[model samples]
Target: MLKREDSAVSKPEIQKVGKYDVKEELGHGAMAVVYRGYDPFINREVAIKITDTDRGNDKDSAAHRRRLFFNEARIAAMLDHPNIIHVHDAGIEGSYCYLVMEYVKGAKTLKEFNKKNEILPVEKVIEIIFKCCKALDYAHSMGVVHRDIKPSNIMMTSDMDVKIGDFSIAQIISAEVTQIGGIIGSPKYMSPEQVKEEEITSQTDLFSLGSVMYELLAHVVPFDSENVSSLVFKIVNETPLPVSHYNKDIPEELEQIVQKAMAKDPRNRYPRGLDFAADLSKVYRNLKRPVVDIKEQAKFEQMKKLNFFRGFFDSELTEVIRAGAWEQYGVGEHIITEGDIDDSFYVIISGDVLVKKGDKAIVALKPGDCFGEMGYLAKTQRTADIVSLTPVSLIKVSGTLIEKMTVHCQLRFNRIFLRTLIARLSKTSEELAKYRPL
Candidate 1:
């Protein structure tokens, strides 16, 4: 759950904790309350996490809770990853123990992205998981296991940067085992080993991360039940519905990645967090990146407005858009050289290019103009050199991609090429007549 400063319960809040002054309640989890705080000496805003001790029944329970809070502070302080939340200070004052952390205003948790009807975009989800994987890798290298890796513990900044928070249940492998056997972590996101209360490892974090990714992409938890018993039973014995069953748009490759991460046996899951991150990075590179997509759409729209495509249907234009690759050339850069045997064409989106033959400037082509049609359509050697007269944006269409176009689109393209060829030949004849032997 994400609680903004404005939506705080309006109850009387803590005025101060050590050197920091509390501004308001930011959020509250079962074990602690997070507060918006201001550090006076540093004049910086911070988040303060205070342990909730009211739930402790006796002296032993209260000490156990305190130990848990201190354990979190120690574990979090040891981590120095960008994705992992930074711990600034921790101290105990009377009955209250608090930790000062880096504050992220307007921050939301991954839980918000898991809404049934409003899941996050697949790319965004992949990026979040990728970051989490690296963060976990760093923590694991430091001999720490964030036993409770779940959506609510992963915070998202206003700019969509991920911050993996809440290490209250973390286990430091190098430290003496003070707590064990008792079940820990959220049941819904737990690994099969966690459900069975078996010895946990770095692989446990990957399993929980897989659950978080699944919820974000498919808008449903991998294992859900009305009671803890059934939930634990399912996690230990059942297989989750393939993510594609819930969201078909999710690629099969991505589904397989998620499945392997959430495998029932630790041996089947990624060997390390770095391995998981590597797979996510591959998906990131292959997916239509947001920045690239925006630029491509702009090119597509420009293509639609050109006279060359005026007669083309929307479907045909879309095919062309998919077939073409955008490229840029600097002034004096050669696009096509004379006598080159390449079957590709170019259309100028911006700037100008000079068509040259035997060191003679033939003609200058500007925006919306095309060259190399003869080479592309006839599969012959280039007759001239096309060099950029100014910095240029060009759409390059390869013969291979064009060959994959639908029959109707290919026919339309061929007709336009023929018309363009005739027009150029006619102009050449007129020039030849003007230059006839005098």
Candidate 2:
């Protein structure tokens, strides 16, 4: 049995409801317990959400508290969209009111995806959010507003199907609320109005959706803080850095859309879900075109900052930059295998590469770090496997290119090459000593 909280009893201990027999406890929230159950009548599996009745003890009593749980079920049952999880039934058995919903196997939340630190392709992100937009539009048309929209509430299945779940904080537009400062939603995804405890609109949902997209692209939250007070202050008053600042690969049009969606003023943001989806579609189309050579230009800009190359003549530095070629590799993909005959030394342009001797990793190479220098100097087989730890980009200078350059300018090449080789060997020896037995 999979329980959200470790202290909760296993699913078999939970009493059966109607024809459904609990198989496993999937998760538990503030107001309900979600379980994987077998529906004997239907001869299939379903997710059963059981409301927590012992939440409050007053004249209003447990029944009054249970009504809010049922309200969430009622609102979810009315939402019919491919991206929305369908509610099958809702009923009370003794003290528990349970709602039966569709069971999606092998589904993970956006929070789980972030743990992997993957930078999603722009097209795929747009596709996922397009489905979310349609679902929100449909929910809005039915006069329902999802007050809580966060990464944990959105599920991505194995086949990449997006499903929105957890409608507990949803407002029915017609309902009269009594609790002020109840603060019913996730803080990180809340819009400015929600933070201030003001009336919320469809624009609030769009604001949350934009935050999710921003995180997917940049691998960081819009406003980051370690403490609760600082986090709240930044979310309410501070503006996030432009997405392009972190990830240069993001299309400019897409960046603009994210910025507009997260605009502090609701009026400045997209008016409706449809408008947001339309902008994303347009950006997707533009992204399919050939990318300009901006990355190469960035490399030259970086070279200008290097102190080692500062004293070199412009023509010499330009020649060295022109001789380099960009190479990319997936994590664990071997850029250079130990004992292989190779004459090229690599300068890491971005990301990290792991230097491995046998099955153990020796060290990681960050931007500006060079590898295979020992081989280049000695003209021998590679001493270690250089594998990518993340998606990596490097500038490769082939043995033949170095040879040609050395032939043209022997004195300069000898001075620089010998110094680089000696430094690399010294570092390698120091690293090896750390791993050696005392």
Per-model TM against the reference: 0.65, 0.61
Number of backbone-clashing residue pairs for each candidate, in the order shown: 0, 0
Compose the digit string of candidate 2's lDDT tens values, residues 64-90: 547676677778878988788888888
The top-ranked prediction according to TM-score is 1
Error of 2 at 419 (Å): 77
Question: Candidate 2 — which residues are off by over 4 angstroms?
Answer: 1-12, 55-65, 117-119, 175-181, 289-438
Q: Please provide the root mean square deviation of candidate 1 (C-alpha atoms, Å).
A: 16.6
RMSD of each: 16.6, 18.3
Q: What C-alpha lDDT do the candidate models reach, one value each?
A: 0.82, 0.74
Candidate 1 local Cα displacement, residue 125, angstroms? 0.6
lDDT string, candidate 1, 1-438, tens digits: 121233323232578878888988888866678889999999999999987453444567677779888888888788998789999999887556789999998999988877665568898898789879878988999999999999989999998888999888899885876753378778999998988888889999999999999999888899999999999899999999999999989987899999999999899999988778767755664574221243656876888877777788888777877667667778998989898765568888889999999899999998888889888778688989999999988777765457567898888878888888898899999999998998
